[model samples]
Target: MKPLYNFILSAIGATLLSGCASSPDHATAGHDAAAIMPASGGPLLPLPGESLVPAHDPDDGLFMDALSSWLEQNNAPPNTQYEFTRIDLDNDGRREGLVLMQSPHQAWCMEYGCSLFLFRAHDDGFSYLSEISPVRGPLVVAESQTSGWRDLIIHVSGRQNNDARNVALKFNGRGYPSQPASAPGLAMNMLDVTGVKIFP
Candidate 1:
């Protein structure tokens, strides 16, 4: 709860200072285009959506390790800010973790978007499970399942995509697609925004 409060304040400050402008041709909600939605009557595990950090960090600095590795690879500093969320991606009792590594220097993002990682919990702690590169939010944990895992509705844009889109990333046994722009499209009738947005 403390982490969530801090994250909200940070997000508000960032948005006010940066304006968080959108691309000129990016699709707006006015389009009413086809996009991801929860499967009919799928059970939802209620959780906070607008938090910038997890209520509790994964044990043993599992998340920080992954962030440090990514920052080192990109030559970004370890102090970069990020957004985090937890969801029951497998419809299991335990929730998995989602981290969006953000930096003022654009270290983690490409033209497409920033890198988003999903961590699976283990008895020892949390372990690296899968990654979705170049992603933006607010992301959705959909009720729809693939390979026994919930699908992710991610905001995608940039070079590969002429206009921005909400792409559905399904777990393919191994993991979700690293590149969301190349994923399959959903029809336009997913009007109801079923799941909560994961980050601010």
Candidate 2:
């Protein structure tokens, strides 16, 4: 009987210690240095149908869900980080989605550098239009519509090799590889060009 009692007491003590260890610390629980406890925030309420919501707001659960679905569909390799930039590429008073994927140190060598993907949201869902390669640092996209078709102009640069770099100016439409132009020179390395016109 004595042995059983000791074992029971030890098990109880272990359970108590584990519970306390899993709980968040007071500092992390939003308590200040003065030890004043914080109040419980209000509950979250869903927006009504047809409510006006900003597209880029992270708090919007619908937008977050859609973005997550897109990311998962792309199947980004492990250790790759993506930065999304929103711009009005079409200049139609609506913002377009531009995603820049970079590999910090991944097994895929081609993904180690930079890649750009352009997307536009529609009534059904977002549509992926084109993808460009050798896109290094920051990216800026602008729209140039001529005749009855829309053209997306993308500017990207990256270190091609030791002591040598490359910058490419490409365009895509409903059809891809329609417009291709490139310039390479040692002095032009890393220099930002205002805009390069792509001829189809």
Give each model's whole-structure lDDT: 0.51, 0.34
Among all candidates shown, the one with the greatest TM-score: 1
TM-score of 2: 0.45
lDDT of model 1 at position 159: 52
Could you estimate the TM-score for every candidate? 0.61, 0.45
Give the poorly placed runs of model 2, Cα more than 4 Å off.
1-63, 107-112, 142-170, 175-200
Give the alpha carbon lDDT tens digit for every residue of 1-200 in model 2. Answer: 00111000001111111112123212211112222111211122212232332443222122223434444444534344454444444434334444455444342125324455555544323455555543444422323343322433433333345423333343433423411224333233223433222211
Clashes of 2: 0
